[model samples]
Target: MGNRLDRDQVVGTALELLNDVGLEGLTLRRIGKELDVQAPALYWHFKNKQDLLDAMATEMLRRMNALQEREQEAEGGSGTGTWQETLAGSHRTLRRVLLAYRDGAKVYSGTRFTDTSYAIPMERFLAPLVRDGFTPGEAARAFYTVYCFTIGYVIEEQSAADDPGRGVKGIDVAERAERLAEFPLAAAAGAELFGDADAGFEAGVAAIVAGIAATRERGRKVN
Candidate 1:
């Protein structure tokens, strides 16, 4: 018989297993085995795998949102130097964290939690946008767009964890170029556009924020 596994211990062990084997490889039985306990023991803490995943996601976001909130507080909730800088910082942090572990983005995007842990980051990240005259709804939408793009980009960027040479494999640069030659604009910019993840994220966030600012300015004129 093994000693009792506390809530934190359970979550920590589960997270360890998740990182080692990914979301698809994680299971209650495996976690219990790792802790030298029966599967039923885990059930006592988490109702099911979904419950465990929700808790894990909450835990991960809690740490991220905390740092963001502190930065927000330091910057006065609304007056950060550059909203786009803040967005880039937050999303870059998120991207790095998700890419550090296996299937991290999938786990994060798949779960739903009501805990304000998730919203605190958004509130902080959106502060600059709101201060810049974007309506609350616009800020929210813009935030969502940046977040979705970051997650999607990371997932696609790291999906080939099982392959070491994934990047070079099947990459027929010449063929791809020839195929896209019909579209002059895409062909010209395709390589440059997809080359840098960080650059793409910054550009995307900048464009979104610019659009929001424009919308706000337009609305102000109308009003």
Candidate 2:
């Protein structure tokens, strides 16, 4: 009898290949080859490339879900900190997880299955706004801003890793400093903006949370 491959085994292999070859290079044929099985065998578990990608995406979200659940539990089953604190912690945890593999955010964002990862956080994040007197629609919009900032930030950060020299190749800093001297503020802050993603991520999350609160207050006044 042939060795029956389980779903976990298959998805695990796919993840392994994803780390090794990235999304573009991942294919059923390649996964099968890695598994020492026929390509057709993979079809028994997944319908197509998208199906496989969705499974992988779900697996990643599963990890995030577990982490957040434990985090919430540690807070005595409620998000005791400020909403910014809760959300920033989640973002930091996510960045660490995604950074563990090659093309992690690409695998995450490129796949269509974000509901598993998003739904819980969405609920947790929006609840504060709703409790604070914002309408559901307003809260939803705020959540989108935070979501967009985090996702966009990670994608740009990871893409930089692929190109080496931190994506500023062949540019002599001394020469660039002379050119940027006309813009003193830019020269002073450019390094801060680019240095240390952990700090940047926290700062961006803080700004977004503040923006959300301010927008909610404005909406309350208009109402």
Candidate 3:
């Protein structure tokens, strides 16, 4: 496993450890063991476990940016789609990436990337919103709105998926049905209230994007 370990190598190994052991079990000592190096060797690359987690988060963003670029290229350089489409696509990609690893959303939620490289993707995403009439600050806020929503959604999704028992404790399908039976409207609503997660996510994304557009239009009328 020795090929002259570097920061990227350390971070890469740590990310693998993350997928295997999750955020709670991950530690520099564990990562070092996986890399066949001493715990102190990791400090040479990352200051501490938090720094390693930040690096992992940064790597996730980097992969997403590269994926976006590839998607745009596949579209024959015409760009990925309209601003709304692009934002939705990016959010979906973020969710997929986060869900790929154990506690991924939680790890990313704790990170504060010191890497300036993330600015590339940030600028690329915001440019369309700004061009579409949002001020730079407005564009940033809009992006943050969607980004935070996606992160929170993924966190809940992962938590439920990882521990189904914890999610619906005492609420089995039959119990859920019985509970709703007393409420006529809820009983009739049925699966619509708790099914089709993808549709639910898309509906939320559409609402946010439309809200941003509506705000932009209001600002236009005022000026």
Clashes of each: 0, 0, 0
lDDT of each: 0.73, 0.72, 0.76
lDDT of 1 at 70: 71
**lDDT at position 79, candidate 1:** 38
Specify the highest-TM-score model's number: 3
lDDT of 3 by residue, 68-154 (tens): 788778878755356787688779888888877777889889698858888988878877777776789987888889999888877
Q: What are the per-model C-alpha RMSD values against the true structure? A: 4.1, 3.7, 3.2
lDDT of 2 by residue, 70-122 (tens): 86787686765665665567677777777666667777776777345667766
Candidate 1 structure quality by residue, lDDT tens digits, 49-138: 999888887877876766666766886865365777776688877887776677878878878873776766777678887787667887
lDDT for 219 in candidate 2 is 70
User: Model 1 Cα displacement at 197 (Å)?
Assistant: 2.8
Q: Give lDDT for model 2.
A: 0.72
- TM-score per prediction, in order, is 0.77, 0.79, 0.85
Worst 10 residues of 3 by lDDT: 164-173
**What are the clashing pairs of model 3?**
none
